[model samples]
Target chain A: MNEQLAFTIEVFLNGLMAGVLYALVALGFVLIYKASGIFNYAQGVMALFAAMTLVGIQNGQVPFAHLINAIFGTDVHKFGWHVHSFAAILLTVIVMIALAWMVQQFVFKHLVGQEPIILFMATIGLAYFLEGVADLMWGSELKALNVCASEGNCLPQGMNVWLEGTTYEALGYGFFIDNLDIVASIVAAVLVAGLVIFAQYTKQGRAMRAVADDHQAALSVGVSLNFIWVLVWSLAGFVALVAGIMWGAKSGVQFSLSLIALKALPVLMLGGFTSIPGAIIGGLIIGVGEKLFEFLIGAPFLGGATENWFAYMLALVFLVFRPQGLFGEKIIERV
Target chain B: MLDDAKQADAQVDNVLEVNNIEVIYNHVILVLKGVSLNVPKGGITALLGGNGAGKTTTLKAISGLLASERGEVTKGSIKYRGQDIQHADPAETVKQGVVQVMEGRHCFEHLTIEENLMTGAYTRTDGNAAIAADLELVYNYFPRLKERRKSQAGYTSGGEQQMCAVGRALMSKPETILLDEPSMGLAPQLVEQIFDIVKSINEQEGVTFLLAEQNTNVALRFAHYGYILESGRVVMDGPAKDLRENQDVKEFYLGMSDEGRKSFRDVRSYRRRKRWLS
Candidate 1:
């Protein structure tokens, strides 16, 4: 009931919400890495591209409008029509799937059986390439992703009045919590649950795990490496879309949106690259740790902005103590 | 009557035929120089050789696993069921009923034993019921696998891991299995047990086996046919019985001769006396 305690609870809650967002992005990295041993440097750019495509589709903006105008000397941009948010999302998903296929077919197919470092480097090139393509398609402008705003059921933003009023009545001080954060937490929970079921129950899921364990053994058992790799890429794309939606809705879709992936790096180091549960828990730990640190010491003693580097510092500590992350599979060596 | 049936089998078309295949690694190191062999249906055929003698290369070529390692069958052809398959994908080869249980017991280390076996049936379109039935059949052959079915494969003993690898291959219901060095790194008793299972799998299931082994004594005992390889070439091949009784094989491989148990140092003068090489 103390005023400080209530505010601390509020900060802790916000940190948890932010952690959920980080885990969402980190989930994409874990999916591709676990399946192919490729770190997928383009995961952030994937989120950026997915968000950009969603906005372009929703507003019925012409793709490559700038390029078209430059070539034809005509000012043409929009189709003069609006698409439903749900339809836009569906189309975006289709586009993401197509992108996944092309990435596998054109880029990674030739790089099969290459060293992990080579694969990682290829993803870096892919990230920059995809970013340029998305920029050209959408014209590199910030777009507000209202997400069903046209339908009058837009993604809620700002503090929840109900939670604030109830907390004020009960504890003599209101707790501030964003409705968007609540939604993101719920989405993340559902996404994680769906992924776990898909991985643990399906036939293709079994093959995915088999490929992750040993590519040679999986191929010998008749599991197609190309198919599984594409499947994994598609899954990662789907995760990226979900993450992009949540983050974009919170702070209008922009190039800065992709920078959230940098935040996910520390979370992965803490959680372990190959673990799903590790990502979620690691995100939560990082979320709470950074927020609490900023509140207690960062703002007062370190003059604020400690949240920017607190997660990385904490992750570095974890890396030193547990190089495998909190839940990475231990390497087994036969002596 | 049995001898007549055996003679008829010898005349029948082979399930797998490799004709003078030359394997080059990284396009430079020639690992298999014109190696050739045949695997008859429902028989254990042993490819025998010392280390680096191209035993594993021959099996990988048959299974189409060489491509992953940058090894190419450049000079000759490999035919499975009389279809040319030198350039086929390993998964395609598996789908066509030929599977390779890779050397060194490459079990899916993180998966449970049952899950690891189930992965072998990844290409089967016969539904889970058939897969379950095959799983039970595999369990019957390797009961230890069934007991450790819930345990992570990497944690199981080496013998159990070998059994799991073989049992995993069986779950695919393969018509022909290219087994590479199943006896490697195991105790003598465990080696005998695995060989026994391979023999039974061949007899009861009527599955064809092309096994590569360094233990010439045991491979000769169980194999119906044998090909002895030396430095990327098949030096000699015959019925398993003949290879077991051949004079050079006795001195070099089985560690016995007419003079009885002479060390390699004592037999150095006879090194160039290999009649097949000569």
Candidate 2:
């Protein structure tokens, strides 16, 4: 193998790693979109809030710690709750679910029957509001999260078997892979598979599909729209929590985690807004295609950071060919 | 009409009674103006009218769909089984055994035929076993629906969709079924078939029916009683047999000319006077 080929392989693997993270965020988008027509622009912020809440509860923050102790009547700090990572994750998930319920019951319930664009704008407002609430709760400080894997640390780097017998060694270039990248890949694949099965086989999943098809029809059939909304939002919150943990472990949890959600917009556009499998495949394509393009075509002309626009450009190309999306149903209009 | 009203008032077993109801749309335009009717138990009643003549509006008002929105029974009351249900929700209406097979056969297009049938049983608290039994009954009435049970409603033909719609309403096991334009847009053969199934459903299930239809001839043939609406008001109403034999109805609706009416009257009186002489 040549130096060029080895570098190309490295870029491709890196793209796959990034795609996994994008898939997680995109999952959240798809979940909310399935149950309610609103595109939840606040999904990224929900992840940020969940991560911040986890840190706050672990650190014994003024209000959260006081409130928890007052309600449960147990001194969390004295009981040594801060030392338990699993407990913190569980508590953060619960708080996120409660927040989801509140959001549906108060904000969304009032805004029902509004136009989809108006609802989208409302979600944007929710995003900003949630970001503010998170900052107030956790002071916008950076925090570290432990990996959920029992291995206790990211996967270690090892020698590539394909590159072992290659002459690329002469150029000090070889296919490199990180332990954390490999684990992230595995986790992403598992999550995607789990979600696919859940949506396909479960009763709640069927209700979600029905609601996505026609909300008014679903309501007429007695599929409690409010309850489904809260359920989907909480499910999205769980996805966000997982995304937060993984991203927090990789880059540390901060406001920047919210920025990662912007990546999912192009993912949604490329895959079509309402598709679950489309999100996963789109994430992978955006992930690997961008990195390879950046290395092969982009580096020679526009320099680095070409990966940032590569997904959007590919998505733009797809829109021209199949406007509804790769997996989306074509919309027909009748007079 | 006042004497008929007095007679209906004396009857205690009225299935549904609509008294001088007014439905206004968008708080401005009146759709149903002082509309009133009564359906007797175990009989088919027809609401006949031309397009946009408040026929469909009346059906929706009784089914609780219109009452929830821009429609208000401002002037009168609706009693179903002696219960005031003017303000009832659709779910509550279904619970009270009143189901409407709405205009256009509003089947859930994306759902499977079987799933659409299950939705009709939404208000039922019975377990899966009873629902399955009802499903079998619906399938028996519309065998075409049974054949396409796993197919999405959108893929079904229009007549088949109508069957699924009516079948779904029956799955709820309602005492009264309101069908709006079940014969609309269907082939002539399918129209006859649908009306026949409706008649059987009435006879076998003892289900009271209030059907709104544009085809006055077919509606009168199947209905036990009928109301003829012209421009949002009932112009004439009586037993279906009497309406079929009425001379005014023949001239205006049945396409009978003056010569045909005169000959028919002469033949009828000649037969009567001959019988008196004998």
Candidate 3:
């Protein structure tokens, strides 16, 4: 292949890889939305919270060290020991589960039967609350998450080292790709498969889907609504944590980690709020579409920020023809 | 007939009982006005009423779905198998062997017919083998459901949805089912077919039922006993035969009188006419 065409293919592959990350976050949204009718805008912040908590626990940093030092002029900062990565991850999972339980107890439990738009807005409030708590707990500093499957900070790197030696030498061009992206993509695929199996086969999964279909019917059939809601929220939290770890390691754990949640909004609009497969497929489409657009048009012509609005514009146009989304059930109106 | 006559003389052993229940909706709107009724063990009893006559509200009260809608029985009591269940959650009520097949046939539209049926047995810890047996039993009653077992409930017609709803309720193995408007919005033939299935389920499975309906014609035909509600009060009640023969019920409810297709063989019609005359 020619140089330009090879470059284009590389960009396209990178776009698809980015799409996998979007799908990770979108899965969190889909899980919570499907089970509880909660369009959780807090999902991104939940990820941020998880990532911050994971790093703080790993590094043996005192919770609220900065706030304590500022308030009391204390010299205390570190706990003087480090937690193993596996231990920190387990602890983070516990924290996420506890957070899920608390969120249900405090925020969502009282808001049952509220409108979807209202729930969505409530989640936005929850996002702010979670962000504040995360900042208070972890001092809100940029932290490098270090729990990679292989090497170089949370994921394997230097995948292009091999490509440059053999495949690229034959073609007079090397395909540059991050092993982290490839690893993240595999983790996402595994996460989605696990979720699908849980939803399709397990009793609890069926109960969750039943709750989604008809709350009253599910209740009458003897599935406790509150229990199912908690289970769903915790599952979403775990998903958010996975997303957090991946994104945090990529960009350094910071406030911007939560903005990736915004990138997922167009994915939801395209995929439909209640669909799992839709979230994945929608994420992929948005991921690839934005990348290709930026490469072919934005960088060369309309400026480099077309990636900011391309997904949204595409979702808007698609929804005009199919309002329920690509895989969402077509809504049937009854008088 | 003899047993029903004995039931008319006194309460013939009820599996579920509602006594003078007053319900309020949204803390202000009073919906059920001291309503009372009984379901004879292993028999079908129909509660007949017009729209807004509190039939659905009464079922919601018994099933514990009212609270989710902000409706609560603020007065009186409901007993299932001699246990007070007025404040029980809907899931609790289901576990206690009383399930309500809700009005409007709220089948899980996204679920296949079989999955919807399986959900009805969600609370049961009984072996899968028995649950499977009960599922086949449900399919036998509503064979159309078995034919469309894999089809999504949303795409099915109204009659099939109703059948699926009832079949789902049966998966719980409930002793008493509070059926709300099973005959609503269906062809006359389908209505009769549904009632026939209900009757057989009552007879063969030995399941008791308290069905609230507006169709007095079909309800009275299949029900062993009938209670007529008007504006949330139990205005009239008797064994099905006596209720069918009553003058006021014949005219106002069934829309039949002496001149209609209904026979006036009973000489008591004159005395009943005098009661209306005064």
Candidate 4:
């Protein structure tokens, strides 16, 4: 009924929307970490690369054009053609699959049976190498990813006018909500449901979980570790692409987009790295906690911008109480 | 050196032939030094040894699981039905019908009992009906597993986990199972129950078994043939009946001498004077 209440409700709704996006990214991390125990520092970069690749393919830009032009003294960038967004997305997925295969074959295959810390260090190296390769392939420039069909069907931007007018008429105050955020929430829900079904029912999905539980045991049962790892990486890549398209559309495809992973770290800490539902719930908690804190106390008492650090602070406090995370398997002790 | 009576039993077609295999761990530590054995088809062959005597290492070598632990069969060969499988991967070995149930019951702890059994059928290309039939067969063998099928394996007791491991392996329809220390950490009664299941599985399913165990008395009882290993080498090999009657095995392994039940103090000194080792 009041302006403050309406604004608070608006913030809460926006926080849920943001949490969905965080969960999208967190899904990628959980998939890879669950299967192989690799933290996959490259996940965020994989998103950036997928988004950039999608844009490049849609624009018909030649891969490594700059390097080729510099070497051969030929000026050729694009083929002067555009690809349909749907076709470009399909091509990007294929490319992501190939990248998954190459990563497993060239990098991780030899690193099998190595320590977790060693595998983690390898992923760190892979992240930097992949980031550099993506920049070289697509050129480091801001690009707009257009997934919409046309002007009428385009991803609607700006505040929802209908919501604002309706809320104003009902409560004597307007609520702000972005149409893009609503779309993101729906997409994230569908993605999560699909993942849960696949994991719960399918043969390969069961194998993935088996591998996650015990690699040696899974192998003994005839589960191919290499195939499972590649499958997991490809799934992670697909999730990353979905996340990439969402974030890239929100703010043009840029280097800073990868920093979204830094935000997801606190989410993982809160959710536990081994859980999917924990990720979603943790993301929601972090998102709402930060937004509410910024609104109530951050602006009025503390200097504004507590939103930047609030999630981490909350996650740190949460870790003190529940280190295994909300949904993590409890470590059982036997005397 | 085979005796006349036991030599005739060795004529059965060997399902698995592990010949003079030397396993090296981390490329330096020699674990299995030219260990050799033969597992007759449809019989339970036991590898009996003490701690660190390379029983588990030999099983891992045959099952192609040693590579995962940074242990490699660096010398000799392992043949399953005349096919060389020393370098085959673990998955390939499983496909070839050789599955190793690792020691300490390495069940997928997070998975439910049924889900863990299903994972054993991962490599099978047959339809779900076949897998379901096998699931029922496994449950019949391990009804306790069926009762706790929905419970997570981590919460299961030690004996139950051991049974779950064997049942899970059985779901793979394996020809030969390399069971490593199934008796470890189980009560004596539970160990007897597990050995009974292994005997029944061997008789009913016609599956070959190369079980590595430290309980020489029980292992000798269930096994048709037995090999004794000391410091990674096969010290003695014979039919289980003859092995049970061997004077050296009785004194050293079964912990009984012709004189009487030897005390641990005298046995410790007598172990150093092993005639077989000399």
What would the TM-scores of all predictions be? 0.95, 0.80, 0.91, 0.95
Residues B1-278 of candidate 1 have per-residue lDDT tens digits of: 67447746764969999999999998899999899898888888999988998999999998888888888999999999889999999888988999999999899988899999998898888988999999999999998888999988888988999998898888888999999999999999999999999999999999999999999999999998899998899988988888999998888888887877987776666665663455
Worst 10 residues of 2 chain A by lDDT: A159-168
- Residue A68 Cα positional deviation in candidate 2, in Å, after optimal superposition: 13
Give per-residue CA lDDT, model 4, range B170-260, as digits (tens). 8888999999999999999999999999999988999889989999999999998899998888989988888999998988888787798
Query: Which pairs clash in model 4?
Result: none
lDDT of 2: 0.78
Question: DockQ for all models, in order?
Answer: 0.71, 0.20, 0.54, 0.72
What tens digits encode model 4's per-residue C-alpha lDDT throughout A233-271? Answer: 999999999999888877889988788888888889889
Error of 2 at A320 (Å): 2.0
Better of 2 and 4 by lDDT: 4
TM-score, chain A only, candidate 2, equals 0.84
Total backbone clashes of candidate 3, pairs 3 or more residues apart or in separate chains? 1
What's the distance in Å from true for residue B30, model 1? 1.5
Worst 10 residues of 1 chain A by lDDT: A159-168
Flag clash pairs in model 2: A155-A179
- Report, for all candidates in order, the number of backbone clashes: 0, 1, 1, 0
Error of 3 at B200 (Å): 1.7
lDDT of 2 by residue, B93-178 (tens): 88888888877877777678887888777668888799899999999999999899998887788999899989988988899999
**What is the Cα-based lDDT of residue A164 in candidate 4?**
26
Off by over 4 Å in 2: A1-3, A58-80, A83-94, A147-203, A330-335, B1-11, B15-20, B24-29, B66-79, B82-88, B228-237, B243-278
Report residue A149 deviation for candidate 4 (angstroms). 7.1
